[model samples]
Target: MECKNDYLCEKQINMDKLFEYSNRLIKETDTKFFRYMYDEINWKNRMIGLIGPRGVGKTTLVLQYIKQNLNPSETLYVTAEDFYFVDNRFTDLADTFVKYGGKYLFIDEIHYPNLNKIQTFPYNSLINSYSLSCQF
Candidate 1:
């Protein structure tokens, strides 16, 4: 099923662009260099958040997992700092992705979005509504 909303289509385009960027990064990432936390993280969880200082390899870990485990068509990797978020809402991206059958959404740099603007139920409701698994 495809969305008819032009705005959502625009968001889908942004998502495709992000996927292209993420694929390049994932291709460059060396899976042999595994982090301790990578083994510690339970990839089966509905939602996961990795919090730590910069250069901690969190993004690389997620990218590696996507490369090794998840199917590309079922997953999406996006960053909060991406220009797409400047005009589009995160929820809108989630909605469009799910509509098109995305299952796992990995968001890098999760802290960049304004918590106040995102408001309540954005996370919990999103999971309940779409059954989308997110990693940050």
Candidate 2:
């Protein structure tokens, strides 16, 4: 279901749950290892990837950045495996986020089902957030 009133984009996104989750993670101090990379990352770059075995602070690093610099209005963070992705396509979500003037998007665990759908998305639309910036 889509939001009826567009200005209050609040209705479009699950802001309440998102804030609760984001706040919980942001309160903790940054991790000792790998956390340093967060600051070093060129968030402005169009694409970034973190490849490693599990247990690293990759997710935490991104979440910390979101909590530190971005508010719900400017950024959106979601895992590829999230239920929200089941019914909705990522590109569609990007469109809606752009419509509401979103600036950042963070997607974790990108190796989810239907990875090919991303290939179908228009290349430009992929980072419609050209002005939007986020680190992976």
Candidate 3:
């Protein structure tokens, strides 16, 4: 029981930090310059994949949408390269995020994570059941 409590406490702490980082990024984004495809891509879609060259504002576009639209607490923005991935699986993060009431998950640089982990059963099962709007 004590060990489980400690794990839960640690998870909450990590989530708090993740949300803080996400909010900071959203706050810093200026929606003034909208990307060309921003409007074309339907935000209503469950999974939105933005493919483009580097420095083309893919991350900025999603940040703008999250800032202008979604509730901060319900949405989480994480990059595949985030330090959390070092000790955690992507599916585990997704599961915990959902448990904490996360509705939208924006994983920038999605290609950076291990493809096998992202394609595993638990991850697929989570997305199928949850209202996840993943942006890669």
Candidate 4:
């Protein structure tokens, strides 16, 4: 099913634009910091967490990994604070994203309410619920 709200559509489109922009940002930046985390982190895991104070390069690392490791066509990167999600539910978004062949969901700002809640649910809930590898 598709969203009834047109604003959500526009926002989602912009979100896609953001992902493209993110890809360019990753490509343009100097990511030497990626050497340690890129090689060290087990990207094969179903769920991975990066915790640190603000201004750290966590988002850059995830975007770089997505750019280098995953299929850009099948992956999605959404920041939790997007106003689009205020009306568009995360569960519904996940349903639609996976329904459309979305494989990797890289969510930034996971400490936000919606994502933090997902973290509390059973591990299999995400993996089993949506055949998608989610990283926060």
Which candidate number has the best TM-score?
3
Across 3-106, the per-residue lDDT of candidate 3 in tens digits comes to: 26878888888888899999999999998888778789799877766665667778888899999999998899987677988888777788888888788888
Task: Give every collision pair in model 4.
Answer: none
C-alpha lDDT of all candidate models, in order: 0.70, 0.57, 0.74, 0.61
Instruction: Assess every candidate by TM-score.
Output: 0.78, 0.64, 0.81, 0.66
Candidate 3 lDDT score at position 122: 41
Q: What's the ranking of the predictions by TM-score, best on top?
A: 3, 1, 4, 2
- What lDDT does candidate 1 reach at residue 39? 86
Question: What tens-digit string does per-residue lDDT give for candidate 4 at 19-112?
Answer: 6755666567565556576688788887666666555777777777876777776777777666646776566556556755777776566454
Off by over 4 Å in 2: 1-34, 112-117, 122-136
Q: Which scores better on lDDT, 1 or 4? A: 1
Deviation in angstroms for 37 in model 3? 0.8
What order do you get sorting by lDDT, best first?
3, 1, 4, 2
**Worst ten in a row by lDDT for model 4:** 124-133
**lDDT score for residue 19 of model 3:** 91
Better of 3 and 4 by TM-score: 3
lDDT by residue (30-133, candidate 2, tens digit) is 74445667779876665455545456767777767666667756676666666667766767656765665766766666653334345754343332221223
Q: Between which residue pairs do clashes occur in model 1? A: none
